[model samples]
Target: MRNLWNLIVQYHIALVFLILQGIALTWFVGSHGYPRGKWVQRSLEWQGKWDQRMSQWDRLTELDDLNRELLAENATLRAELHTARRDGVQSTYQGAEVIRSTWNGASNPFVLNKGTAQGVKPGLGLLQNNRVVGRVVEVSENYALALPLINKSMEWSVRIGPTGPVARLVWEGGDVTRAMVYDVPRSASFAPGDSVVSSGFQGYFPSGLLIGKVADETPEFDGQFLTVPVTLAADFRAIRYVEIATVQGRMELDSLANSNGQQAP
Candidate 1:
């Protein structure tokens, strides 16, 4: 208490001057409102900017939630579409994201984010933007493996667009960028730009899904057929998502094969 009294005594003059200056400032501002009003307006403007930044942060948080909800809704709609198509009803197929790609000769397989749980199954046709990508060769509870068009063992029945001829699409083990369309007649008059599409002859895929365009054509060893080289429509190296085509009457094809004591080639 003695020290406090001594310190107060030492600063009493300086404190008196500060109080006098504050009183004079208040009197000056109250007497002339323009300067004080400008200061108040500037302070309010600064506060408004702070509030705007906070509002932007809140909006970003809301947008993130909206995006997640939309993704879930999309998945649900796809499942319903698959069910409708399988039941022989006309409906749109769902798009599934590609979670992994194994194009490095590891059986030439890819993994999709959806699986049997999402109505995906083995032998279902895989497509990208209405172009044939491949087929589902393996499935799990939450994932499925796809055999891309580059797979050496992959084969499909395809027909050229509009006026072109039908042939068997097969991949040659040596060339990854090119595939051979076999059994096309030499008289089909194929050119370098004919579009190839699925024939749906086997009922595994819907007819008219694009396969590729003819990059070149040459006579085959048999001298009666032409080997039409196709450039794949789907760029396997850049594929990000694909649609799984659930065709109607898949079971009928299976039954016919079983009756013949044979499986799909």
Candidate 2:
């Protein structure tokens, strides 16, 4: 208290001038209509801007919550759609967020905020906005590792169109938005905008799930087969929320295939 008193005494002249100046300004504004009106207007403007900023902050919080709800709803709908497509196809679909992902690597891998505890397991398929994104390759208690379509080491079984021939979709490691389908028959009737869908032979994704669209790039001829380019439907660079489909009979199918001396996809 003594130190504060000494400091105030040292700045007494400046403090007195500031106090008188504030009093004079207040009196001037209170006595003059124009100044009083301008002061009120400035105060209102500042308050309005503060209110607007608060409203924006509230909207951002609400938007995040709404997105989470929408993601969960979409996951439920996708699960129902898949169930309705096949009889006795017991699958559980859950919503997940991509916590980490890489699209610029030769073997792009992603991490999802789900794990064995959340029913996530190896061989499960991942989808974003109803489009095939990737498959879960490894799972732990609280996380899962997935390989996206951009991975050069991964190949997906896809068809050119609804009734078109099935081919092997593989990434060539250059463009993140595009992939190549090899062993596609030269006589396959498809145009630039034809859809490429999952063949379901791999037992990872459901049949007819959209993988990509046939790109406008020129096809390369490899003898009787054509290597066609495809524009992927899932945007790896923008992956946020995803749906994970857990096929119930996948293990059984794998077991049967192994007993028959065959590998399941």
TM-score of each: 0.62, 0.74
| Tens-digit lDDT string for candidate 2 (1-265) | 9999999999999999999999999886554212223443344345434544554554567776787799999888877776787645566688887766777777777767677778877789988887999898766556677788888777889998878887899988888999999999888888898999988767787678899999998999978999999999998998977989777687887788779887423
TM-score of 1: 0.62
Q: After superposition, how far is residue 229 of candidate 1 from its true place, in Å?
A: 0.8
> Which pairs clash in the backbone of model 1?
none
For each candidate in the order shown, give its overall lDDT on alpha carbons. 0.69, 0.78
lDDT of model 2 at position 152: 75
Model 2 spans > 4 angstroms off: 1-60, 85-90, 263-265
TM-score of 2: 0.74
Tens-place lDDT per residue, model 1, 146-259, is 788887655788897855666789877555667888888867876787789888765557776788998865546577887778888888887766777777666777788779
Q: Which residue runs does candidate 1 get wrong by more than 4 Å?
A: 1-92, 217-221, 257-265
Indicate the worst ten consecutive residues by lDDT in candidate 1: 31-40
Candidate 2: 10-residue stretch with minimal lDDT: 32-41
